[model samples]
Target: MAESEAILAAWDAYSDRHSDADGWPLDEVAYGWRMVQRDSETWRAFLPVRPGARQLLATAAFQLQHLSAGDIAPHWPSHLRDLNQALDRLEELRRGHAEVREARRTSGPVSQEKFIDSVAERNEEAWGYLDTWAAKGHVLLDVHAAAYKAPVRWVPTPAPTTVPARRAGRHV
Candidate 1:
């Protein structure tokens, strides 16, 4: 099956299992994963430009941190640590890109080519970190869905229907 189909199937299974209890936010998780997949494909086509790539990286970091702060962290400390490491590397790449941009701005048009050349390496490094983070996130989501469980609340019983007595046993 295609990757997206597999992901959808897994989500369906997880939702079925956790139908009674609150768990991960499905919309947020799905959106984040979609962004990661799109970014990876774009990276393969060509180096992602700075603004869009930064946004994607920031989104990934936020999602990772959200997962880490939730019930998943305790159950998967190693995966959480890997995500944190990836975040650090991504941040470093961001700083490097910013510095290059600043240098280019101050150097005027003459050095534009030089700056672009320098940024290519940093962009590639950013893509590498992002790819690793995406893979780790997939594993984290799968494991969390498989193992994590929130507090179970029993389904409330329905109230009894109040039926009026037949009118003095009169026939309908």
Candidate 2:
């Protein structure tokens, strides 16, 4: 129960941090170019560059799924076009950012030029749409999270076995 609240709080904080853009300088934020960018809908954090923007697509997947649920906002479908457009932009930006990094790596430190463009632009653009959607349906997250809270799993680790006799297959 507590853990679920923590998760919801963390998710809200993250969404706020990434989407607020009040004092954040989109140009200076390395998240767009240097670090991986996460979309608001997915509720994920920084991820690494990957093949074909799988993480990039996850935003649309989550949004689409949430819309399909039909219990969120009364007008979730209104955001579908924007979400799809954001998906396209995100995919392009991610691919371009990856290519830029590859170019910089191969061209040696001397090559000041990179294949990267205004990554922040695409990132902010995508999040702008997502933020609008989230703001419109802000209640959904809280209500859903509270309603469907799951039990926290506790994984216990085995004690250390530094001694040879303590080995699993050895002297019991």
On lDDT, the candidate that comes out on top is: 1
- Clash list (residue pairs), candidate 2: none
Candidate lDDT (C-alpha), each? 0.54, 0.45
Clashing pairs in 1: none
Segments of candidate 1 deviating more than 4 angstroms:
1-75, 143-149, 152-172
Kindly state the number of residue pairs that clash in model 2: 0
Q: Residue-pair clashes per candidate, as listed? A: 0, 0
lDDT of 1 by residue, 16-83 (tens): 55444565544666644554445444344333333354454355444545443444445355655675
Which 10 consecutive residues of model 1 have the lowest summed lDDT?
42-51
Q: What is the lDDT of residue 44 in candidate 1?
A: 42
Query: Candidate 1's C-alpha lDDT?
Result: 0.54
For each candidate, give its TM-score against the true structure: 0.42, 0.34
